[model samples]
Target: MDTSIFTDKTIVPEDQDLIRELKETSVLWYAIRNHVHGLYPDAMDEWHYSGVKYGWSFRIKDKKRVIVYLLPREGFFKTAFVFGQKATDVVMESTIAPSIKELLKSAKVYAEGRGIRIDILDSSLVDDVKQLIEVKLKN
Candidate 1:
């Protein structure tokens, strides 16, 4: 169990042992972790919405605007993004994977926003997730 991999402590659970085990199980998880922490080192904010889910805030100032939520599962994880109305159009225009593009189109837009979930089952998907995040962040 180690705390060194943590970038935002607010969302991370107290069970360091569990986090360490999850990190060891999935390499894709590590890639996502590195990208999130490395992309916004100082300004990164996190909130654990529930026992097994945590969201990341890619905010402008301190408004607590969460862009993505990461949910860890068996040997993989899903990154969920709730894009605003404007961003949804941009996402439709972006050059993301065909599957993900469909996900974006069909995601329900509610009181919060349009939500889409991308499962990080392989390292190859990291770039797509990052691209989607960039679009969501801009929104």
Candidate 2:
């Protein structure tokens, strides 16, 4: 998995607490996947975000799915930059936003604890993904 984006910077694995946060992110991500279809029945394929540590954007069934790209950027740890699919009118007012909100909340807490700042790419409109991202970041 050519992790060139992450290799440009150094990440100390010795941060046990950050390690724990990564583990937790994995677990919560799994749960989010399981709930994807139910949340957004029209989600689509997964797309990787550039210039992020672990940034990836994908669709569950049709709606967009966004996750934290835990990578170090210019000496700052960046997290939760929205890289998911665009949100459509159908998805903007749907339950997908709330569901994604919950997922991001967990991710934000985990990333923030590790001294990371979260941001959203906001390229997807099918899921109001940008708004979801901003909500989490602001909160």
Q: What global local distance difference test value does model 2 have?
A: 0.36
TM-score of every prediction relative to native: 0.70, 0.29
lDDT of 2 at 49: 49
Q: Which residue pairs collide in model 1, if any?
A: none
Scored by TM-score, the top model is 1
Point out the worst 10-residue segment of candidate 1 by lDDT: 51-60
The digit string of per-residue lDDT tens for model 1 on 2-79 reads 112334445454435335545644566555656665656644544443321233212222246665666655455577
lDDT of 2 by residue, 1-139 (tens): 4232233223423334333544434333333344443444444434344445543333232322333334322222233344222322223445654645444444433322312234322222223433433333323
Top candidate by lDDT: 1
Reference-based lDDT, each prediction: 0.61, 0.36
Q: How many residue pairs clash in each candidate?
A: 0, 21
